[model samples]
Target chain A: MPKVTYRQHDGSEETLEVRAGTSLMLGALTGGVEGIEAECGGSCMCATCHVYVDEAWLDKLPKVQVLEDEMLDDTASERKPNSRLSCQIEMSDALDGIVVELPESQI
Target chain B: MATDEAAGLVVIGGSHAGHQVAIAARAAGFEGPVTVLSDERELPYQRPPLSKAYLMGKQPREALLFRPAAFYEEQGIDLRLGVSATAIDRAAHTVTCDNGTVLSYRKLVIATGTRVRPLTVPGSDLVGVHYIRTLADIDAMLAELDRVKSVVVIGGGFIGLEGAAALKTMGRDVAVVELADRLMTRGVGKTVSTFYADHHRSQGVDVRLSTGVERLEGENGQVTGVILSGGETLPADMVIVGIGVLPNQEIAEEAGVDCANGIIVDENTQTSDPDILAVGDCAQFEGRFYDGSLRLESVQNATDQARTAGATVSGEKKPYDSAPWFWSDQFDLKLQMTGITVGYDTEVIRGDVAAGEFSVFYFKGDTWLGTDTVNQPANHIASRRLLDAGYALSQAEAADEGLALKELVKAARKGG
Candidate 1:
């Protein structure tokens, strides 16, 4: 299991010990962590699950796909270099202790 | 009120809107008992993936669930699966289910989504013919996957095309037969329909436009081919039909709820009785986006209305006036659309369709109507925002590729 930390817009954090093979969006959603609307049900169709990954953990995650890259530009929060659609990121034991900050809104 | 028979909130249908009503009711601090009546045996799952990722094996069955099985119990929402509400007792405010369980509710949300409109042609009930609506439908279709070599899809709608793409992706021969001259005519614009038809053709899918199926040719109770209206027969081991869907508004209508094409609801999703509310495909709502009273059959519409209706049941009343947005995936092209493309005077193409990255902007005179984006997600998102804000972009300004739509919207907001 990997502990994924979801930081709210108000600087609060809720860490969940997520099982491997679950998506970051699903992990946050199933754990009842607020701020991830995931309107498309983790299908990568909607950008409602946008999250800013911690700068240090960027390379550890998989490379961003072109669709995700385009979706990142449409996030409610300003698109930083670390922005990624959390649905596109699969969680695993190898990527434990990953930290993601939720945007101000997922509209 | 009888506490045992009566509930605080009850949601009919178990798909997107029904599930959303339950979740939203709980989220809105509705402390009373919440129950969701789902006719399907399985828990609430995403229907969009059943045609694409699930069919292509990119994702498994468990991945289709909107939430884990335990989430409902944890949220204190009672999920009565494999049981359907047989009748609605408006006077008593109770719903009778198939299992002889009569549950009363303080507030009733009718999210009984549409069922598949069965093909009525001869031999339509053959074993090899299928309609894509539920998880069970996909599972039955999946059983014939290994032996199926050539598949004839009966409609060029989203489900039919997505099935064709998924079958093609899995190394099978596929063909689409659409009675209309173009693909997705009822849902999208003519240009988009043509683009998708060409896109499918380029992918080796035999896109047959203006073709109709007269009958299904079957052997030993199994479909083997399709007889066309043009007096030609196409050999196919499997057949999938996706013509369209009708609203499952019978339950509400029978209860004397005002119904035309569907159960009519006010902007608050309240029915004529006020105690009963309707949302999703079975709901007809008046709006400025479409030409007349609209009964949208998209997940986005269902979930949005469900949220509004759910919130209302929980003591918060918000008008459901959000712009409609929808998405579809087929053969590497992601199509995203916003607003309803009705009564548009001019359509502007923004990018190169040949290259597969383009957008079509629809406008009525100077009023921007909607946009259809293919493989351009940024445009899709921005289009939703612009449509939601009621900001209109002129055809000329939108046609110019140098202009950024988001920046234009921002400038307009600042000027205001």
Candidate 2:
């Protein structure tokens, strides 16, 4: 299992051991971490699961796909250089202890 | 009258809308007991992929779940799977389930959703005939996939086309029979429909428009062919019907809730009886974006309306006024649409349709109405934001491929 930490906008954090091969969105959803809507169910169709990854772990994550790059433009929150759709990130051994911050809202 | 302790929020149907109501109510600080009754034995799952990825065996069953079972238990939601609300006692504020359980509720939310409009033609009940509405339907169809070689899909709607594409990809000969003049006539405009029809044909799918399935031909109680209205019989080992859906509003209507096509709900998602509320495909309310009353059958509507109903249940009244959006994935084509394109007087095309990436911006005179984007996810999102902000792009600006929709949305927000 890979550990992931979800940091809220208010400086609150919750860490969970996500099973390998599970998406970050599903991990947060199953662990009851708030602010990640994932409304389209990990289909990269909705940008509700937008997250800002820690700069150190940014290179560890996979490159954003074309569709995801387009959808990131529609996030309710401001998209940063490290912004990514959590649904597109799958947990693995190489990406252990991933740290990501949740936006204030996911409308 | 039930005591306050015994009366809680009871939700029926247990699909996307029903599941959302329970979770949203909890999120809104509703401490009362929340019970969700679902006729399905499986946990709440996604229905959109059943015809696409699930049918193509690209997605597993576990991936279809909206939330894992533990999340519901952690939320303290009393999810009763394999149970259905048989009747509602409005005066008594109780719901009797098919499992013989009578539950009392302070507020009841009806999210019964919709069922596939069955094909009533002769031999419709034969084996190898399936409709894509429930997981069981897909499971049953999947069980027979190995034995099915040729499939005739009735209706060129989302389900039919997506299923046909999946079946074709799985090495099955597929033919789509649509009674309408074009594919997805009820949803998309003629250009999109024509494009899809051509795309499907290019992909080796026999797209039959203005063709009707008069009856089915079967042998040994199993469907073997589909007879067209023009006396042509197309050979088929399986038949998939996806004409449309009818709302499951009988329980609400039987309880004397105002019903016309679907259960009538106000802006707050309350039914005729204030204690009862309806959301999702089963609820019909006056459209904020379109004219007259309409019932939307999309995940956006279900989730948004459920959120509004949950707020009202928790004594926080918020009117439901979210713009409608939907997406369909078929054979590498991702079609995303925002707002209602009905009654559009003009349409503007952006990007190259021949390249299989473009968007059709719809407008009524000078006012922008909606947009249908094919293989253009950014435009879809930007179009939705523009619609939400009530910003109408000039036809010339919209048709200009040089102008980025994202920039337009950003400009609109900054100017507003």
Most accurate candidate by DockQ: 2
Q: What is the DockQ of candidate 1?
A: 0.49
Clashes of 2: 0
Model 2, runs deviating above 4 Å: A1-3, A7-21, A31-33, B1-5
Please write out the lDDT profile of model 1 over residues A29-79, one tens digit for every residue.
Answer: 778787887888876777889999999899999999877886777677788
Give candidate 2's error at residue B161 in angstroms: 0.7
- The 0-to-1 C-alpha lDDT of every candidate, in the order given, reads 0.88, 0.91
- Residues B72-130 of candidate 2 have per-residue lDDT tens digits of 99888999999989999998999998877889999999999999998999999999999
The fraction of reference A/B contacts recovered in model 1 reads: 0.35
Q: Which pairs, if any, clash in model 1?
A: none
> Each candidate's TM vs. the true structure?
0.94, 0.95
Task: Spell out the clash pairs found in candidate 2.
Answer: none
lDDT of 2 at B196: 98
